[model samples]
Target: METAYTIRKMEKSDLDQVHEIEQLSFTVPWSKESLLYEIEQNLFAKYMVVELEGKVVGYCGVWVIMEDAQITNIAVHPDFRGMKIGEALLTFAIQLSKEMNAKRLSLEVRVTNYIAQSLYKKVGFTVGGIRKRYYTDNQEDALVMWVNVQ
Candidate 1:
């Protein structure tokens, strides 16, 4: 049988699981404390988690500032990759941004991460520029992409 998944606002209780996916997905993961601060203290931040069978399986975060929304981070648990969870999370973020009156949505993906770049492109993002050595893990460059969501 197939498992069902649902996406909802991120809560303090979800940090541990969200951090787990962050560690699994990135070379430099954000600390759990940072996640907590974003959820609890950051006024411009919005985060959502995808739960599979009542367990957090993926998450995405965005910061809406004025007319633009910038995706801060997004990840799916290693065990949940290739299950369309990432796409759903991103799609939801886009909709949420629009509802918040954002006219454009943007994100940065590692230049070498072609799979993620393709996925972003598939969802209407286009390469806008490059941030040289944007990633501290290995000094990897990041490609900035954006889409008009309004």
Candidate 2:
């Protein structure tokens, strides 16, 4: 079953929950300090959080550089999986990239994560290349994907 969610720009209050989701969603989740650094100090970064009744359930982030936007991270809480929240977050990020004058968007997903690849494809991103041993935690390769905003 699908749950109602609201997507919006992340605020300082969401840091804790976002960090928790990152830890839950990834095998080698980023550190809380690193997330704080990105939120506090990264000028090129833009992030959004998804809430279900004011509780953060998912988040996505991207770095806008010149004419390109690179997705840095995206995750949905385990309990919220299969709710299409990830898809909504990706679409929101892509739309924001266009609004920020990005001519293209790129992201790297673990090669084994077919669900994510399918979502990217559904959102019009194409497989561009592969990054060998992209994940240090498991020595897994990544499928590089891109979407032209032109």
* Model 2 TM-score (2 dp): 0.95
Q: How many backbone clashes does candidate 1 have?
A: 0
Model 1: how far is 28 from its true place, Å? 0.8
Global lDDT for candidate 1? Answer: 0.94
**Using lDDT as the measure, which candidate wins?**
1
Which stretches of candidate 2 lie above 4 Å from their native place?
Answer: none
- Candidate 1 per-residue lDDT, tens place, 1-150, comes to 666899999999999899999999999999999999999999999999999888999999999999999999999998988888888988998999999999999999999999999889888999999999999989999999998889
The lDDT, on a scale of 0 to 1, for candidate 2 is 0.92
TM per candidate comes to 0.97, 0.95
Overall lDDT per candidate, in order of appearance = 0.94, 0.92
lDDT of 2 by residue, 1-150 (tens): 557889998888899999999999899989988888788899999889999987999999899999999999999999988889999999898899999999999999999899999999999999999999999999999999999875
RMSD of each: 1.0, 1.2
Q: RMSD of model 2, in Å? A: 1.2
